[model samples]
Target: MIRMENVVKRYNELIALDHFSFAAKEGEIIGLLGPNGCGKTTAINCMLSLLTFDKGEIEIFGQQVHPNNNAVKSRIGIVPQELAIFDKLNVYENIDFYCGLYVTDRKKRKALVEEAIEFVDLGKYRKFVPKKLSGGLKRRLNIACGIAHKPALLFMDEPTVAVDAQSRNFILEGIRKMKAQGTTIIYTTHYLEEAEQLCDRMVIMDSGRNIASGTVHELQNTISTQERIEVGFITEDQTIEAQLEELPHVVKVTKRNGNYLIHFEKQENNLPDLIKFMESRGMSYTELSSERSTLSDIFLELTGKELRD
Candidate 1:
């Protein structure tokens, strides 16, 4: 439904998007992930024609993206990271105003606005102005406004940021419902777990480039550490870490919270080999757990673990 190729955007002496390329199919949730200053927002702005790029092409719904392309703009919706509601407008009026941008017919727009209120569970606050609602409620109203017209493609940037757990879950479930109804959503968030749970595929960006793009399992397979086993032994020996390192396929071992976290390369017998080696030495353990590499691990491995501004 969307395609961008070798996009280049520069600002004075700095480059915001350097040969970045990405694509999204219909009815899929694509996660756009990156550290700060990585050009995620820049790329989105270029696609939305909010910002023009120096090079490359961006197409949405099989047509070139432009600011004045009302046909394309009418079929798209944007829920930005910040709340876009007016403080003076009530919930129903806020949603109605945004929906009216695309839906001109008063009767159809009114029904769509009511549906949006119920979809976001904002019926109770339909008459409440932005100042009277809580943070989570305000977020719900923001979502309702953007989605009231039922656009085919939606760009949701950190829709759940700083909201309570209940509201977050509600928003996520509502997103799933949108997907079920054939809406393609481009999702962005700082919460890795949320992206892992919600996105069908992800595109990781760094230094204004598309570093990696794939499903979660595909990304996991690209990293070196395939599995991690955390073990806490009741009997402590000074050489226990070194001894465990001798096991087959062992990459490295690090201490984490009074436990030894053993990193291992891909192997089917990692756990069983460790268990047999411990049995031979008569070593007993207090706690033992095994898990595959997670999205956080993949992210850190791809992007250096240094702080980003």
Candidate 2:
């Protein structure tokens, strides 16, 4: 439903997007992930025509994106990272105002506004203003306003950020319902687990370029450490780390809360190999656990562990 190719955006001496390319199909939640200053926001702004690029093309719903393209803009909804509701407006009025931007008919807009309020479960607080609501409630109201018009494509930038767990779940479930009803959502968040859970596929960006794009499983295959085993030995030995490194497919081993967290390359026999090696050495483990690499692992491996401002 959306396509951006080789987009390059420059601001004076700084290049925000460097040959960045991204695509999203209809009815899919595409997670746009990156650390701070990675150009994720720039890419989104370029696609939304909020920012102009030096090169490349952006198309939504098979038409070129332009700031004044009301047809395309009307079909798009933006839930920014920051709350976009007026503090003076009550919940119902806030929703109605945003929905009225696209749906001019008062009857249809009113119905859509009510649906949005119900969708976010803010019926009881329909008359409450933004400042009167809690953080989570305000977030729900934010989501309701953006979605009141029911655009075909939605750009949700950190919709679940800083909200309580309950509200986050409610928003996520509502997003699922939207997807079920055929809304193409472009989701951006600092929360990797949320992205892993909600996104159908992900596009990983760094330094303004599309470094990786695929399903979680596909992205996992591209990284070196596919599996991690946390083994705690009953008998501690200083040489255990060196011995564990000798095992096949062993990438590296690090200490984690007194347990030896072993990183292994892509292999099925990692756990079995560790058990056999420990048995031969007469070593006993007090605790043992195995887990596949997570989205955070893939992200860190691709983006590095350095702090980003």
Candidate 3:
């Protein structure tokens, strides 16, 4: 639904995006994963035509993106990282005002506002002002304002940040529903677990460049960490650790909490092989669990950067 070709942007001497290119398909969520100052925001701004790029092309649904394009802008909704709401306006009025921008008909806008309120589960707070609502409710209100018009493409930047777990879960679940309804989403966040759960595909960007982009599995394969397994033994033994290291498919073993955690290069289901090898050695383990490299791990390894400012 969105595409960028050799897109470049600059601020003074610093290059925000150097030939940065990415695309999002229909009914899928694309996560722009990156650390702070990685130009994630810059890329989004350029794509939405909110900021003009120094060079390159951007298209939405085959049409060139433009700040003044009514068709493209009408189909896109952006919920920024920071909350933008009128403190004095009541919840219903806030949504009605934004929805009115796209849906000029009073009857149509009223229905859209109601649907948005229901989608965010803010029915009770419809009459309350932004300042009267809780922080979580205010975040939801911000989202409702952005998406009340039912845009085909939604840009959710850290929609769940700083909210309570319950509120976060609600937001995540709501995103899933939108995805199921075939709404394309460009989700950006530092929360790896949330991205892992909500995004169908993602890209890790740094210094205004896209380092990796693919499904979760495909992205993990790009890194050296193939399969990770941590086994806690009933008894600690350096000899056992050494033997475990020599086993087939075992690349490295480290001791921690009287246990041996093993890492291996990329392969197919290497954990079972490690377990079979351990059984052959007559070693008993109290606990054994396997995990793949997470988005955070891959993000850090690929970008060599942190998310914090």
Between candidates 1 and 3, the one scoring higher on TM-score is 1
**Residue lDDT tens for model 3, 227-284:** 7789988876768877877867676887666667788876676877877887988888
Displacement of the residue 305 alpha carbon in candidate 1, Å: 1.6
What TM-score would you give candidate 3 relative to the actual structure?
0.92
All predictions: root-mean-square deviation over Cα?
1.8, 1.8, 2.2
lDDT of candidates 1 onward, in order: 0.91, 0.90, 0.86
Task: Give lDDT tens digits, candidate 2, residues 107-221.
Answer: 9998999999999999999999899999999999999989988899999988887899999999999999999999999998777888889999999887888889999999999
Question: Each candidate's TM vs. the true structure?
Answer: 0.95, 0.95, 0.92
Candidate 1's residue-wise lDDT over 76-162, tens digit each?
999988899998899999999999999999999999999999999988889999999989999999999889999999999889888
In candidate 2, which residue pairs clash? none
Angstrom error of the Cα, residue 256, model 2: value is: 1.6
Instruction: Rank candidates by lDDT, best first.
Output: 1, 2, 3
- The per-residue C-alpha lDDT of model 1 at residue 57 equals 93
